[model samples]
Target: MLRSTIGGLLIAFLAFGTAAAQTYRPAFDPGALKGPRAGAPNMVMVLGTPHLSSFPESFDPDRLGGLLERLEAWGPQAIAIESLSGPQCDFMRRYPERYRDTVEDYCWDPAPARAATGLEVPAATAEAKRLLASWPEEPTPSQRRRLAAVFLAGGEQASALVQWLRLPETERQVGNGLDDVLVARLETLEGRRNENTLIAAPLAARLGHERVYAMDDHTADAAVSDKEAYGKAIMAAWDNPAVAKRKALDDALADEIGTDEGVLVLYRAYNRPVLAQLAFEGDFGAALEEPSPQRFGRRYLGYWETRNLRMAANIREMLGFNPGMRALVIVGASHKGYLEAYLDQMHDVHLVDTDTVLH
Candidate 1:
């Protein structure tokens, strides 16, 4: 008699829940109210790219010439890259247990710069900003060198490179706070294969821009209790046919990355509308459906969403500072779709169509 009563209650509860789910609707949608009622809209283009470091050693950097030309023609006044800000890195450093690995892997130590300039991250960042605020129409090589040193002290390597690149080859000497160690580091960055060094910094220098923004965030990294179990669960979820298909596509594209035309083709493929859905199926979507006792997949999905949302917010905050500017954001291909969707919801942001620019 008790079992039958419990069963009856469960059925009624399920029916009521189904009705509630079907009838609910949001009161309004913020995305529909597009804007900048007075002037030109803030234009942003997100270029999804594979990590240049992943390319084979034989890959020629000059092949990027055509790609750089196309991007320069777009006339972006500001550029942002997928690198953690100096401030963020400094903040994360306060909690060693939580962010030790992140710092070791992603953050550049400002120790040497601090020793040279006698300024920590915050102070160096402040100095760099203050110098740029009243920057002269024609800054001497000494001024550029000073700014580069401050940027290094602030842990902004790419921006330092921009300053380094803008100077004449002969002017890249050690002085004005740029000690021998810092100068040597700048020289090393010249041949680095990373996208920020190869694409963003050089492009900014060519455009006469002072610095490129670093807007990546990793505060959402999670610490799971059962390490082995969590890893096994996520790995098991990824063992799907969709993942295999995606790998096959990536391999084919990578094979053709040796030439300018091939590089452009790879960019085109990564920026396509369909790649987002494919990415979801192969990674996040598959993780969401994993049947784990601890629901490890859900945890992974939560972390992914949190990280992307923070990154999108950082981009939005950058745009909020100056309206009606053309901004170029270069990020890992997997992040492109998520960022575009988030930024599209903003009232004043106008997403530039990648196809028009890439072609």
Candidate 2:
């Protein structure tokens, strides 16, 4: 009688347990993705790429063809590029005097382009809106030649491209009426001197897209405090040993860039989340976390985060214009993790699996 009673209790407990299991709810629900602003959640995928000029001389293009094809095949509704454009470019153009010192020291040469456009930097800068607004839908081949010339002259390549694609397809030929200087420049770009020319614009053109989003943020780039002091503080506080080790790894990777397979390997590693975290660590890890008088590390981290936050916001706004969109962001590898972290916070945003795309 005791054994039978115990068996009955066990059976009852099992039945109750089975019922509870059947009623359990899962953590994920498709309904959670749909928000008030969007009919369905939008997906974001951030791809980290090496800066175009950062690659070694022996870098191969053949290997990247497959990668490019896959990305194009994925057919994202929108693609965000890392170039300084949209409002940031407007700010730079409006107050060249304020930003010129830094920009000229590092990147961009508007001289050749300005000279070719027959307008001074400030004059050409002022005309961007007018030109883009009135740009041709099907530009003559000579017009494309002229735009290519402008590119050689150092005109804003992104804006120039915006104007170029409006023209007819046949009018966009590079060699037509273009001198060797312009032709050479076109060849250099086709060979992938910069990601704008090498990948972003061309891929967009292939996909029949009209414009690419310029998502870079430079608002927090200016250092407010004693710049020299901040610099010194960071170098002193940072883990120099880690920096040296990363440099060694970078050097090793640089050596492998010559072959197509090697380039993909390098890029895949670059796009990894671990790599982005490592980048964050190198950029401000020790300085911000350690005890210090200057605390420049924290300040630096603050600026970086601010810039990334704004960038992510810009992307979100872009998505707001279209419902249920999938956007692909191509940015410098360092920005990948930050962008992803911030973008993931949006209520209706979904981050696509980068691992699947990359692998």
Candidate 3:
């Protein structure tokens, strides 16, 4: 009788648990409430790419001619890159304890431009906008040079490069607020092999754009109390089969990027729909299960998501100002999935199929 009573109670508890699980549902879903949006929808293509700096020293800029041709044909009215904005860097500078490394690595000091223009990041940014707002349709070499100087002062080197590139080779000399120091900086930027200078800036120039938007964010950085232990915990979590496979795939792709076809193939693989799930499994998923008492994995995941969310918001804000325009975003491969998912939730934004564009 006692055994039978115990068995009956266990069955009753299981039945109640099942019933509760089946009845659970969320009260609200913002993703489902996409609405009666005004004007034409914004079109965005997020291009996932490996950092060009990782390429071999022999990597020629001409190797990218084919990739550049396709992007130019896409004709994006606006271009955004994975770079920290000057204003954000300035803001982060105040909190040096948390962001010293981030600022040093990502933000270019505008001291030279500041000296030439006598304006800080804020004023220079405002001046760049004001000049563009009333910019002449047929701006002279002098005007372009002046704007480039202002853009440099504003901490937008890529945009400044656009102006410098648009000018005739002979007209690229020091003048129109661009002193000797500023001219030298632009010259150095022209030979840079990184994506912003080689890809985004050149593409913007080819498409007759005045500037490229910097939408990356790193303000999510937090100084861990036990930095050494935190690093060890995260590294231990990453030592899984999924991570090994991801590394193998990345290594293989990096080797094949010698030609145009190779570059396109690499891009296609990175932007595959399944790559997102694979990335989560190898990275954030593994981290979430880390056995560290400090919860370092969860902390890393939080920072990753926060950065991507802020980046998506910056992109969305840019689109909001210029509705119905086509925009292309260039970012690291890891960020592609998170950015697309976040931007998809917006009512007026339409994500262009990356595969279609790459093809």
Candidate 4:
């Protein structure tokens, strides 16, 4: 009698549950399916670079020629550099008085370079394309100088810096329309930013590209909940050891860039899988081990991911305009892993084999 009573109750409960489930409806909406409107997956190469000038000493841009040549051979449709976005450049360009003081010290001087090329910032870039299209083999030194001047006037300082590198050391002086201080500042900026100004800018110019995309962001770093405490914790945890390791690696890489195929070797090692692992996964793993407020290690990683996601979004938007575009992203080594990882998730993006270029 007890068993039958329990079985009856079970049957009643099951029947009620089944009725409830049957009466429910799911709000499912499968929106229209879409395919790749952009022809081929965009190819992107994330080249990891060390912030060299962040150290006490900086290397000459010319040391990166071999690596730059390899990148140029890849023939990227666009080159995304780790700088302020296009709007920042335009802001500085239009109102030097307001932004000149705050903008990176390397923002181009419109006067001298423009005077040399007989074109303003807007016109100079167009003229540069025309010149490259009709470039002569074994052109006179004068032609090189003009193109360099045009590159500078068009706000591609790093490319102009390459033109400066082609001349003899003694001839690398600023004169006529170009200012001495301006020339010095270009080298300074390249070191500070750590792009192969030699690689990115010159290659863009060589391929008739008007400008390099700037995709760096500091807003994420600025928005930590407890900014001071978070910074102190990060510094205490990573700064010293990080600085020491980076300095040693940079010093060694600097020494290597002088030898045959040294630049290639340096880049290969710089872009190695182990380095990226250390930057993203390792940092996050270490963060997970922290305690209390100092445990902002996760937050640190969060901020990093946020910044890279935004950058990837920018690259995606850029691609929206030009289908099947190939872009090479020159970024701080720490950022390379995050950017590549985030971009890889996008359906229309196909990351280039960085090892091949590095090798």
Reference-based TM-score of each model: 0.95, 0.71, 0.91, 0.62
Q: Candidate 3 lDDT (Cα, whole model)?
A: 0.90
Clash count (model 2, backbone only): 12
On residues 67-88, what C-alpha lDDT tens digit does candidate 2 reach at each position? 6776787788888887765335
Kindly list the per-residue Cα lDDT of model 4 for residues 1-359, writing each as its tens digit.
99999999999999999999999866752222223674576788888877644533445556667777788888899888776542346556556554555355535455656556577776777877798788876655566666667777777666566565555566655653456655665566445435646457667767766456667654454344577887667655564454556557767877775644876787787898777766643355456554555468777777677878888888888887787888998888888877877877777777887887766
- Candidate No. with top lDDT: 1
Could you give me the TM-score of model 1 versus the true structure? 0.95
lDDT, candidate 1, 1-359, per-residue tens: 99999999999999999999999988786678898788988999999988999889999988888789899999998999999999989999998888988899999998999999999999999999999999998999999999999999999999999999999999999999999999999999989998999999999998999999998999987578899999999999999988898899899998888899889999999999778877889889998999998999999999888888998899888888888899999999888999999988888888998888889
Query: What are the Cα lDDT values of the candidates?
Result: 0.92, 0.67, 0.90, 0.67
Candidates 2 and 4 compared: the better one by TM-score is 2
What local lDDT does model 2 show for residue 234? Answer: 77
The C-alpha stretches of model 2 lying farther than 4 A from their native spots are 1-40, 93-98, 105-156, 162-192, 240-245, 290-292
Query: By summed lDDT, which 10 consecutive residues of candidate 4 come out lowest?
Result: 26-35
| Candidate 4 segments whose C-alpha is farther than 4 A from its true place | 1-38, 54-60, 86-193, 223-228, 239-255
Ranking by TM-score: 1, 3, 2, 4
- Number of clashes in model 3? 0
- TM-score for candidate 2, residues paired by index: 0.71
Residue 96 alpha-carbon offset, candidate 2, angstroms: 5.8
User: Which 10-residue window in model 3 sums to the lowest lDDT?
Assistant: 29-38
